[model samples]
Target chain A: MLRLNNIHAFYGHVHALRGVSLEVPKGKIISLLGGNGAGKSSTLNIISRLIQPKEGSYELEGTSMLRKSAGEMVKHGVIQCPENRRVFPLLTVEENLKIGAYIRKDKNIKSDMEKVFTYFPRLQERLQQKAGTLSGGEQQMLAIGRSLMGKPKLLLLDEPSLGIAPILVREIFKIIKEINDEGTAILLVEQNAHMAMEISDYSYILENGRVALEGNSKDLKDNDEVRKLYLGA
Target chain B: MQIIVSGLIFGCIYGLAALGLVLIYKTTDLVNFAQGEMAMVTTFVSFTFLSQFEMGYTTSFLLALLFAAVFGAIVHQGIMKRLQSAPPLNQLVVTLGLFMVFNGLAGLIWGHKPAGYPQAIKGDSIKMGSVFFTPNEIFVMGITLTLMLIFFVIFRYTKVGLAMRASAQDIKASQLMGIKVTNVFTATWAVGAILGGVAGMMTAPITFLDTHMMFDVLIMAFAAAVLGGFLSLPGAVVGGLIIGVFENLIAFYLSPELKLVYTFLLIIIVLYIRPQGIFGGTQSVKKV
Candidate 1:
């Protein structure tokens, strides 16, 4: 339900995103694949309004998000689970999750918190413990669970499995699929092409700040160039 | 024992001012070198309300706190906000500039002469075993402890408090969670200035209201914050008490004139042993 057209983002002298365009249809998991510095993170950051784009139109369900500030994005339900799991290191896990619901004024916050705990029982166990003390895998869970506390319509997952153990990575991907099935659209940025291809319904391959390839995940999986460059098959 | 009790009374005042410094530093990452001058100005404002306007002590104190809150918001919104993204050095210089400006302004408005200020409470010294305390000293410590408790509760239980803590920890992440970080910063300054104003009012009775009265307290407060590890609230209070007790011990055992020198030396030694301050964790270093 999100569309970014001809977006160009700059970081000082460097052109981080050059005329990049992509779309995430409602209730779908759209994976963007790229190597390091291929503008994957830049695309997510631009969508989250973390970095301003000098030229482009970003719309969520036909509503222009250009004027909306970064803090306003979450109110519109475009929540981002930022890269490196930016959990408040000093705050307790419960406190971190409570902050996730900062924009909500409804009384369902306690229920929403319970729902997050249902998804991540580990967070419940460490509710009072500081988030910085969490293991890498648990931190990832806390990050995602924290974002879910915002009741995101379009969840932006940035490297959720990065630096995580292989076993935990599988579990995380499983949760991603489960989250998608439950109707929240996901824009997942991943370097693990194999797991990405397996779960994503559609995929875009980014190279040098442009959309180099785009197709259905199954078709993209079988493409020779895609297999060679990303999947390493 | 008397020395310790008296030291703690002054320590509570130092801690009160340091709480503001730590709060502002935690939320905005700006070391407000001007905090002492700000407190001095607020004390002057209280004096104006008390004597010039013929207001009662309680009314004057509240009015001063209200003025401090508005003054803080104005300073942050009108000045500090402009330098939000500037280099830390530039920010430091700006606050130092504010220190000079506030100091000069206070002198221009109130004159340079020190004046007697009324205490919140008036009574003979209360004797407890070998220790004695004026009603004012007990009042200062009692109010400071109560304020600390209130601050801690608000920080722990409230949504705004959660947003504040979250923003302090990670501004970007808190924004992503829909916290209006600018509002948090504004609230931080307001609360910080209120705490600083309280320090000024409490100290004025003992030190007398003067443009330079808070100068010594500011240095000690900074030392206390550094000792407390800058990021920890409880650390700030404990650090203030440590500095107070240490200074008092030096004054009693050694030459009184050498107290400040020995206190600084002791701080250097303690910091050399624990660079992060007493409660500062490994996550982030203090900017100043």
Candidate 2:
């Protein structure tokens, strides 16, 4: 559903993503494993059109995303739940969800919101509370819930496990699997190798802005080098 | 006693005036330098309608408010939206162009001669022991306070108001969720123009209905905004009251000419110390 071929991204003078290439097939979880500053996030960001690709090509469902605006990507159902859980701090949980379906004029937003609440019943309880006050895990849930509100075909999740409790991390992984099972494709970037492999269909290991290894998530998890570097075996 | 009464009365007007800037800032993160002129322009629209059409003053005033709102929404969408992602300084430049354009347009359309608006309230004053307030002044204060309260309720309880607030806190996040960010900006500007229109209509009765009146109080109102910290609704009111009292006290007790200068000095000192007004919120910083 999403493809990136030789995509390079730069943050000012620093080369962040160097010719990263990948294809995420529809209705599967594709985990991108990399250390800090390995351009895993940048690769997902380019595909979501959050940041521009300095070189190479990024396509969403066969259409080139090189010149697409962030708003356009949102319209095409390419939603990014950016790292750090960038929820609208002042907005109520309900308002944040309402904003997610911002581009779609579809009248089914109300029912879609109900579906989101089913995934995150906690969010429903705090509908009036400001998003800023939510606990780290709750905020993560809100971010993911918000992306789902967009009715996205391909959701880019950048480190869903970051800053959350370990128990919640497992819960979040299960939710990710449930979401993928519901037919949406996912390109997930993570440093949590064990949890990622447990859920992902395919995986890619990135180093210094390039993809160093690509394989089935189960095969990569079994590999001694992959386990030692990523899983701390 | 008269001093406090006068302070309370004009403070209401100033608060109404500052509300426009506060609403715009909260939604768009950009300051509208032309806000004062925009209000003045809208007031002139009221003035023209009153004169050209024997439709009378009050009905024409309402029409002007609606027209100004339409004007504001158009400018916000057509002009400000294009420069939204541009640098802060560039956004300020667009407002500057708006300031000059609104000022020149008002002058050309309304002419230099001040039109005398029919008195909104009779020149009657109510005496409460040692203090007295004119009927018009009392009306102005009442209208401002009532509207502010109504506005607060709408913002706190209404869906659209919540959406506007959401857009202010984070545009990108709001956009992702399905909030039409463009319409939010337009709504903010439209509301801003309405507030500005109301303020001008209030001020016109006290001063001669002229474009230049906004020029004089613009700086004072702006100083009130800066002192209260931009984007703060209540802060603007408090700051305006403080400015009204402080400037009046300084001019009356100290020196009349130094009132304007002293008010700005207060703003500079305010900025030097708290930069953000008491109510102005600081965005959360995340270090990855």
TM-score of chain B of each: 0.97, 0.92
True contacts kept of each: 0.98, 0.57
Q: Distance from true position, residue A79, model 2, in Å?
A: 3.9
Q: Extract clashing residue pairs from model 1.
A: none
Model 1 docking category: high
Query: What Cα-based lDDT does every candidate model obtain?
Result: 0.90, 0.83
Q: Which stretches of candidate 2 lie over 4 Å from their true place?
A: A1-27, A33-78, A92-129, A149-154, A165-167, A181-185, A204-215, A223-233, B1-3, B121-135, B245-256, B261-278, B281-288
Candidate closest to the true structure, highest TM-score: 1
Residue A176 of model 1 has an lDDT of 88
| lDDT per residue (tens digit) for residues A61-85 in model 1 | 9999998988788988899999999
TM-score of chain A of each: 0.98, 0.98
**Interface RMSD list for the candidates:** 0.9, 2.6
Most accurate candidate by DockQ:
1
